[model samples]
Target: MTLLAENYENDPIDVLVGDWMSEGNMTVRAGTKISGQVDAYEPTFLEALQPALPHIAKYRIKVAVNAGAADTKKLHEAVTKMVKGQGLNLSVAWISGDEVLPQLLEAQKRGESPFENICTGESLDDWDFEPIYAQAYLGGLGIAKAFEKGADIVVCGRVSDASPVIGAAYWWHNWQRSDLDELANAFVAGHLSECSSYSAGGNYTGFKDLEPLGWENIGYPIVEISHSGEVVVTKNKGSGGQISVNTLTSQFLYEIQGPWYFNSDVTAILDNISFEHLSTDRVALRGVKGALPPPTTKVGITAKPIYQAEMHWFMTGLDIPAKARMIETQIRMLLAPHLSAFSHLSFQIIGSVPDNPTNQNAATVDFRVIAQARRAEDLAPAKFVRPCIDPIMCAYPGATPHLDLRQAFPKDIFEYYVTLMPQSDIQHRVHLSSGESIEIAPPAESKVYSKHQPTQHTTGNVVDVGSFGATVPAPLGTIVHGRSGDKGSDCNVGFWVRHQDEYAWLQNLLSTSFVQSYLLGDEYRGGRVERFEFPGLKAVHFLLKDHLDRGVSCTSSVDFLGKNCAEFLRCRVVDVPLRFLARGRI
Candidate 1:
């Protein structure tokens, strides 16, 4: 609400939307619900909403959010009572019926299981983990229904992230389910705005360019949509931030797989998408197309605790690699007799010795020992760090550990299960404060639905090294701007140039094989990697399948979400044309 209030004061904002749910968050909420916590929803939302209630009521601004988590009805009641106490006449509505774990478990008991892992072809029962709670990804129709019934605020549980914008636009335009293109445009816009300040220079790779904008006071994005679904995205005036085609392109490619961005209501096709710069702070988005949504909705399932833990030790001075190896050998020897207690275990050496050091800490390297177990007694908090400490007295020279050693204790590791459920199984509803309710009908699957197909990437003709005239070996960042993020277990990277001439060269240079050779090499090889081009936006996008090590649940990778994947690729040395280099880069 801090940022939302800022935008509201700056512009005549009609609606405020917040997206506070993620895959991991669903697992946490499920645990809380099963544990019988009184308030299973987000606790901070009410505190944030309390200060903004007066402004919201005065301006007649509608608020929507998915902070309802596992209990939308509880959230609605709490917010309604708070509003009445403050002498505000605002109506609060909520959408529920997203929970489906009980039914799934009952079906499993009757030997009629329909749930299967989307990535792995294993049935739910075949997996070792047991689900606690499950919720299907709901659409925007319920939220729109609340708005039509004059709801001042509409809270939802596990709906799609773009549903807030989709619902608001649907109510404003009185759009039907057949309005696929308009819904697609709204879906894309909501995605652009959902992360708030991300579209306004937060987490940008080119951080140097945003320094002048007072990063401490960075503003969030506000999108203006026309009836035809065309949009102009901008930020609050007189605030700190920057908006450009490059920034918008980065947000568009975040966490997306292929060209079909699936939602409960529509599948937005990002092929040949274009963005036009209307002003320094505003850009026009167009050419977004759509198809009928898939028959199934995405669902998240949380399983029993797959508890794991780790301990870190820092080694300083020369021969860091040998020291790390010796430590690992000692720990392995100690734990060899107790192998049955652990399901998985590994030792990792992070960082490298500095060539020349100015301080002891600068030349230090870190050694980590991590273990996972199915039983809590097997990997208790006190026993987990015993192996690491047993060798400290006779360890390598200059061996030391961090002061905060509490992290060595075992912790609950929730397994995130990603699967899909038929749209007919989900029951979407709007519970109004005035004792009225609305039921949203499931969308009819199209008979001629377009199969979600990825854009065919082309490996353009390779150019001879000497043909492009004088060249200099420099980081790819010298020629392009890029961003990367995670989508389930996959990582997506999109790199774009500021000039039209650079597009052709970029397309030819960054092919699927070229990227794999530069980044992954022979490590963790063998996965479906794809490359795509957006000529209108002058960008190249890549999706690396199963790159996040099981989607951050059990990944041992340093950069789990692949947020720095593009930055890693950007630092790769490339031969750049002297003409483009002379023009200067971001």
Candidate 2:
């Protein structure tokens, strides 16, 4: 809400769109409802809207959000009551019918095969878990319908992240569903804006260049979609953020699986994108192609929860590596007595001592032991805590466990299941402020799109790195910028250079083999490495297969969402051109 107000402070914002429901968050909400919570909708929407209520009417700003989560009707009622209580005449609407757990279970009972996991090709029966919540990803038609009914605020359950922008554009232009080109453009705009400050320099790999923008109050993004599908992405003037080709390009590649970005409404083919610099803090995007959407919609299901617990031990002062190994040996010996009690257990030593460390904390090593079990009682804190504490007397010198024993307590871990369901089976609707309801019919059946191939970018002329004169071993950030994110278990990192002349060298230097070499050897080299390119943007993108173990809900990786993949890659030492390093402030 504070960010929204900052956006409107300079000029009135015509529309506001927010995406509060992520894969893990949806599962969390489902657990809440399964535990018998009547109103399990997200409350953060109201928390944000309360402060914006005053300016909403004053600026005539319309708001749309996926804050409805799994309970659209309840959220609608809550927002309506809040609006009325404030004596504000705001028209509100909610899009419903994303939940489909009952429908799916019934279908299975009728002898239908279980849904297959899109990434792993595993059927529902293959999972050793039971479904607790199942919801399909809805599109923008319902939101457009609500806007047509004069809704000032639109709330939705499980809509695609980009649906709000598509809906807003549809309402403003009164576009038909067949407006593929225009819708595709709006889709790109929404994708760029969906992550808020991401499109306006937050989390950008080029933060060194954005230092002048005063990131303490980084501005959120504002996209203006023209009638012909052209988009100008910018932030409020004088706000503390940057909107540049690099910033927007970083967002453009965020979380995308391939050249094809699938939404419930359309398949946006981002193979060939063109950008025009409209002005400072603004760029125009064009040439994005679109195709018919798949006959099925993606669904996220939360399965029965498992119990997990962790114990952290610190090895201080001398011989850190040996100390860590000694502690691990003793702990494993202690746990060997009850090995069968745990379904999974791993010991990891994460921190390392620096050369001639000046402080004890710097020289200290952090060793973590994480365990998972089927039963909560099997993972009781005492089972691990007692064994861990008993080692202090005979353990390495100055060995100590974490003071906060709360980390030892077992916690429920939810599993995220991704699958597809036929769109025709869903019953979608829109509820208006005037108590009128409208049914949203499913789209005509269409063939599902086949997998997309990466765009083959021509690497202009093969430039020799030696021609750039002297070189320096520096972080990759000194010469290039990129963004990284996850789609299912895969990790994608897109790197780009600012100058066109450097593209050839960048393409040559960032091959799969080169990337694996910098990953600290084979431990990070388990997956297949695929690379793609966007010459127009001077970017090379790499996708590491199954790098996350599983998606966020179940991944044991420290960086579950893969947001750190690119940053880690950026820190890897590379032979950077002396000229580029001279220009860099890092």
Candidate 3:
């Protein structure tokens, strides 16, 4: 590789390959503590290496992987394994540019800007840094490290999605670290390609019903970038996604906090770029202007994190037409009075009959109430509601006792959106291999980052079993009889929950006749209480094999369960806490 004054001037690099978003990142709740370990995951080193593919031989690549673990040991192990799996005979290792840990603490020290630490407020020194798992959304500097290391492929976790593109932009354009405007343009590039398809044309308003674009094969957003910071969003040969003005318009909606947010030692003037529709799945980007970033890079940090408290209570009730009405009234009069002191309030009617597009007037509704305050103790004074269920029901004034409410009530307790931001001057290092070269081609499969696939199609069926609160749920499930019969994967199992002293009751019942049982048990029971048969209740678990998918069946891969399992922890099931129960009209 020879140095050239015009490297970025003309005949710019033909292809810049990069990967983003490793694996799991479900931030835990931040209690009184400011810096604690959270469950974070990025693609294993092997997974990251796979993306580099056979192209390792010819081109200079940057394989960026986000070490997003607060646990440095695990993070490093995964990264090391990734490279070792490639036999270390590969190319560049341009780890993620996002510097999550130390920068966060540094930001806490500076107090310049609040850190978007993924969770709540965090102080740098107090944080448990995972060198292997830590990610900083570091932008140019992070990916530039890989370029510096001579890596051709950049792999990262939780990068602003645009960090890779921006890093490449900065490198290819030869845009100096002092150039804020150019750096920002590079930032835009990364953002455009982050969601893959959104930029290439997944969920564009102009092409809502893309007739010719078969969404199943919708390719993720890819960019034909210019050294001058100009770019064209596109995808692989004959992929399903569209790349029109519509797609570009949709994917751009994220990451850009207009007047825009310029990250860490870098900033940009967002309005300078021009978007043009070239052809299907091809959108051209022009007139991207940028400037030198602010001196200090804003860092995001989270306080000591705590697991989100999840509590599920299920109580069944039946009363043809009046069930919905009675439950509403009871909650308003009984539950509401007690829970109003909290932060959020949710009420849903889950049952055979529809709720949203109310189908039959005959279906009975399942009254589900979800409420969350600051902390467990934030609503501590009101914590009395958990135990008040039986007593309150026994004293019901209704002709039918709401007391014998056969169903269970499950409420997951988690704070909605609590994150922080900080700043730092962390210099990242990218590793380039001095080993044998490997040939590779463009990213052709697993086209995930496209906006043209599916949009907010479901209105969140207000009637059936929907998420308790906070807009979307991980794997959307539906009632088998209605919407999701064969659309995805659904499995029916007798669902059961442990209440008061029902542990022995459940064990005795399970010991009878159970097949392939999976219990939602705790420390006492190895969560192996697979055999569940609640005396008066019924629970079934369903998986939308491709519930959140189009072409691929998640089960096709052994890691599929692990993929969504992470999402499950943060997700609510069938208006309950069943890890696998699903709902919807399919």
Candidate 4:
């Protein structure tokens, strides 16, 4: 909201779009709806917009957001009431038809739509948990239709994260549906802008450069897109945070699947996409090819809520491993009678006690025991907490509990199931302020593309790393910058170098086998590791399938969403060329 007001005061503003929905968020919203505690939409959206409403109305700046979450109509009504209360005449519209739980259930009853999991190919019938909610990823055309109908604000539920930008550009340019290239470019711009400050340097590995600009208020990203499909990414003038090729590259790589970026509206070919540093705080993105979208759109289905709880213990000084094992054994032995009650349980020892530590904190490591079950009572004090805590009296030397009673209580856990449904099944609709609802038709041209398409690349040939001369053992971060993010149970890590010469060495070294065996190490569980090359950006991308153990909502891993995967890989020692090392660290 602060950025919105600042951007409006500092620069020309068109549409302000915000994304507040994710797989985990959807699961949470579904639980809220089922419990009837409050409206399923994101309340923060209203809280933030309430302060900025006057500026938006005065400037006639359009607003679009997926803050509607599981309930678009309710959010639309609230926004309408807010506008009327403020005496503003701005038109508000809501897009719907993303919710498909009832429809999916009906189809499943008839043995029609199997609702097969996209990642594991398991049918919904085989899923043991009861599904409470299902939402299809709608296209941007519905939003475009709302704008064409003279809407000043649009609220959406389950539209793709990039749909708002794509819709805004489509309406601004009055482009036809056949404008694939233009739409694809807008898709890229939307992607770059979706994560707010990311494109401007929020999660960038080059933290040293952004220090002078200050991190307190990193600038929000803005894409100045032209009619020719060229995009110049920038931010509010005088805003903190640097907008450079490296920063934008980091954002580009975050949360992506592979070379072919799929959306409901169009398929963006990212293999040939390139970026150019135009000036200070400005980068131009080009060469994003376009193709017809798939006949099906991604769908997220959330099952019945589970319960989880954890207890943390500190292992200090000598015999750290022995101490951890002893405590874990004592707890397990005590809980053996009730072991079958827990659906999943784990004792994770985080960090290692170093030799001759200088401080008490450095010598201490955490041993956490996590428990998940279908019933909250299974993880209650009697069954879960007491067993772990009772062992402290007889524990190994220097064993101490973290002493947080609240951590022992059970919390709701939502499990997400990702799949795809045909676009033909969706009844996309736009509800305008004029009391008329319009139906949005799916794209006439769409191709049937397989998700397991053979790995393709635009890079001509592989480089011989031996030709780079003498090498030194150093952290990969010295010459490379990486970004990682989650998509359901899967995670992607993208690594790139600044110099063209380094691209050859990076591409040759970070192969699928190498990443799986070395970078992932014990973390590389049973799953496929797919590698992709982006020559234009001098980057290599890897997708770790089923890496997050059912993703953020249910994953017990410390890095649940796998956001730190890239940093972990970057910290690993690797053979770096002496010449590349001389070029200075990232």
- lDDT by residue for model 4 over 1-586, one digit each (tens)? 6556645766877889898888878999988878888999999999988888888888888888898998889999999999999999899999999999887788789887777787666888998899998999998888989999999999998999999999999888888888889899999999999998999889899988888897777998889888877899998777799888889999999998987888889999887988999999889997898899998999898888999999999988888778888999999999998889899999998988788999999988999999999999888889988998998889999778988779789999998899888888899999999999999888898998777634533234677778989999999998899999999888989999988889988888887778877878888886887788888899988888888888888999988868898998898998899999887888
Q: What is the lDDT, from 0 to 100, of the residue 513 in candidate 3?
A: 19
Comparing 1 with 2 on lDDT, the higher-scoring candidate is: 2
Q: Residue by residue across 171-199, what tens digits does model 3's lDDT show?
A: 66666666655566667766677654655
lDDT tens per residue, model 1, 1-586: 6456645655778989889887767777777787885677887889889988888888789999998898878888899989999999998999987898876677678876557666544578777887788888888889999999989999999988899999999898899898999999999999999997888888777667888887887787898888888889998777686877877888887877767788988888888788888878899998899789887777888887777778899988888878988888887877776668898888888777778899877888788888888876777754567876688877888777665767677777777777777677677788888888777877886423433336545645455545667888999988888888875667888888988667777878787777777655544467777777777888888887767766666566667778988887887789888888988877
Q: Would you estimate the TM-scores of all the predictions?
A: 0.94, 0.93, 0.53, 0.97
Which portions of model 1 miss their true places by more than 4 Å? 6-10, 105-114, 447-457, 460-467
Off by over 4 Å in 2: 2-9, 107-114, 445-447, 452-472, 516-520, 523-525
Error of 4 at 156 (Å): 0.9
Clash number for each model: 0, 0, 123, 0
Ranking by TM-score: 4, 1, 2, 3
Candidate 2: give the clashing pairs: none
The number of the candidate with the highest lDDT is: 4
Ranked by lDDT, the better of candidates 2 and 4 is 4
Q: Rank the candidates by lDDT, best first.
A: 4, 2, 1, 3
Looking at model 3, residue 271 earns an lDDT score of 40
Model 4 off-target regions past 4 Å?
A: 6-9, 456-460
Q: Against the true structure, whose TM-score is highest? A: 4
